[model samples]
Target: MNKYLELALLFAFVLAETVGMWRIFSKCGRKGWLAAIPMLRRYQMGLCAGRDAEGRQLALLESGVAVGIFSCIFFKTGSVSYMVAAFLLLLLIIPYTIFSIRVYFGLCDAFGRNRFWVVPWVLCDWLCALIWGFGSDFKTAEGYPFDDEDAAPEVSGIEADLTAPGLSINITRRTAMSLFKRKVLLRDIHLIIPMGHMVLLLGGSGSGKTTFLNAVTGYEKANAVITLGDSNVYKEYNSMKYDIGFVPQQDLVRGSDTVYRTLSDAASLRLPADMKSDKRRERINEVLDTFGLTPVKSSLVDKLSGGQRKRLSIAMEYISDPTLFILDEPDSGLDGVMARALFEKLRVIANSGKIVIVITHTPDRVADLFDDVVVIAKDAKRTGRLAYYGSVYDARIFFGKKSMEEILMSVNRREEGGEGRADEFVRKYSALAAGGEV
Candidate 1:
């Protein structure tokens, strides 16, 4: 290669190495700038592996590598003494090399990765660094994965004694094509959604999943009779509005406000007017700690990660402690782990005596977390009708399917004329309206 070309390639390689290491450091909750330094990056990597102890040892090994390389350069000068000194330095380098391998494996293990990472860490350091930084989920020093028992202790004080009557919904939707021309969207939904249950609402695009949510929240223009206990939903919107909380698909928070500030504002606006400011402030603190937002309470809404933002949005409504909480596509932008965590939190909230409904398209992985699932399938006329309503396992058996996705595909195929399966399932399961425990 030409001299200039060699320099360019060297510079590019160094840049990639620096950036990759920097990202790893950042993900490990260390300052990324350490990667830009000559030897300090190794020390930071040690800190990431556990704490300062490992870092100190790694730094010493890095020093050995440096000394060995310098000694080799001196040995090239054709001096016997320099060659002997180089041999002594090479001996130190041998142990340093071994420890370096151990340190790399330690880094992977600390971040919940297996020893399989050793090959990439040794042979393809750049790729290893990139994956470590961008792919791993690093917990903070204080954050530890808790067992089910410990998890309960972590959320001890945040539990609420919410006692609301169970809800049984019966709604009918029809389009206003004309006073005479009408098409039904939802055909008489008469399912009982009990208080304190986590429900999953599954549907495909244009399947009226969102439409059903709006109807329940009294947002859509529809002719429907929805009853929570003995009260008609539409007839009692003014009195029942406080009993419900709806989190739309998109966050409705101001990006400029911190998490604490946004939630405080929500509580102030939504809480009872007779409530004192001190009580509101104390409740805000409870909400923050309940949802694991205490650490990021000062973080601006726009600056939070997608998962944090979603939690914050839910927290905004959770501050009210509504009896019925409906979240539309809360898992839309999150990864599988984040989506699962979000649903797990919702499951806890449901267990505390409130109705929590999540409308989502991707419900397969987290389906087990929900107590019941309501599937809405659209027909040839673009109407969303109930295809199945039952426990996750029973819904599978009721539809003769293994997965939510499989059941949805079967419903759509039926709608598209393969079979009248959806209609038949709805007919057979109509007894759910008459106290059937699905």
Candidate 2:
């Protein structure tokens, strides 16, 4: 490479690394400025570790564990240079070498081949360093395994959801030995979402609400049977995927695109090929109007208010008219009026005979808005399990209306009856769940 090009290449790499990691921070609900400062990145990393995906701290621990063994071999290379080289040769060349094996696994992971790819990547990162030099293009490596993968998932099907399909999901332990670790994060539970019905799920922080949402889409695993009507969802996904719609907790919208273009492109990609541009535009306008966001139809996502942005997210998910509209914490940053308005939109969708589910915190007014509700609570350690699952109306009927002060008392203090209020809440919720009342 030319001297100037090398310098440019180095600068480009540095800039890319900086921007990529900065975007990662912003994605975690933090400002991007922290990524520019080295000390701040470390500090934020620690602060964000516990709350990040799969707890980023665990990622650090795994990387730390891998580096420990790698360092032991690396630094000792000077004193045992020949021995080190010999060992390297043996490891890389011997029968089913760990290096080659891990490299292969990393390739599998890069292409999203399997879940256990991390096992190979951590063990073989050093070997990969030797195989593909720092300056080399990883995508063009001679050992790249694209040819090994028989087929790749089609992007078209992955992003779309089919029309109203009845689903029946069943979770069973089979026996007691299966009971070991039967307590799952989300997918093991049994819930039936009939067509055209709406449900509101409530939890404080976590209650496996998110997990249950993931279960619907098959992101989370379960020994249980997830049936779409009488057909098994898992078996369908293995052979052919359903057109499911999801709006995750955060607005992962491409901030650059204007609302019009964003929805247009999304619809074009997700909708059926036979769908025309006129119908697409009409559908977009109808969705935008449904959420009272028609006025800002041309605004860039970054230019919208928090409330406007949230409405847009909901609108986008239902643009294709999905059978099930699933949203995670759609109420996350909305206020009383905005939350109420959003619920009304969900209500409209529900009344139209589509299934709508909202994961919420038992909003004072929205309680009446919900046709059904499920509550999830956590133990002292923040470990969550479903505390209740049932009909909201019945739970209210059983508990009866309490004065504002009485409600506050329950919220603020334990029971005057000498029992733990938190425990009482657990029992009340558990009873509601056991009785099939929210």
In candidate 2, position 371 carries an lDDT of 69
Error of 2 at 11 (Å): 51
lDDT of each: 0.72, 0.54
Model 1, TM vs. native: 0.58
What digit string (tens of lDDT, one per residue) describes model 1 on residues 1-438?
354575576566657778888987777667999898857877777667653445666676667766665565545455887777687787776776665677776676666667787777877676667666666454323341111011101111111112335666656554645222254676556567888889999877777888888788776646666667667668888777777888889977899999999999899878998999899999999988878899999988999988889889999998989888999999989999889888898889999999999998788989888999998766544467776777998988888889888877776644354343454455445544344553
RMSD of 1: 21.6
Deviation in Å, model 1, residue 148 alpha carbon = 52
The sequence of per-residue lDDT tens digits that candidate 2 reaches over residues 66-103 is 34334434454456664665565454344323323443
lDDT of 2 at 14: 40
- lDDT for model 1, please: 0.72
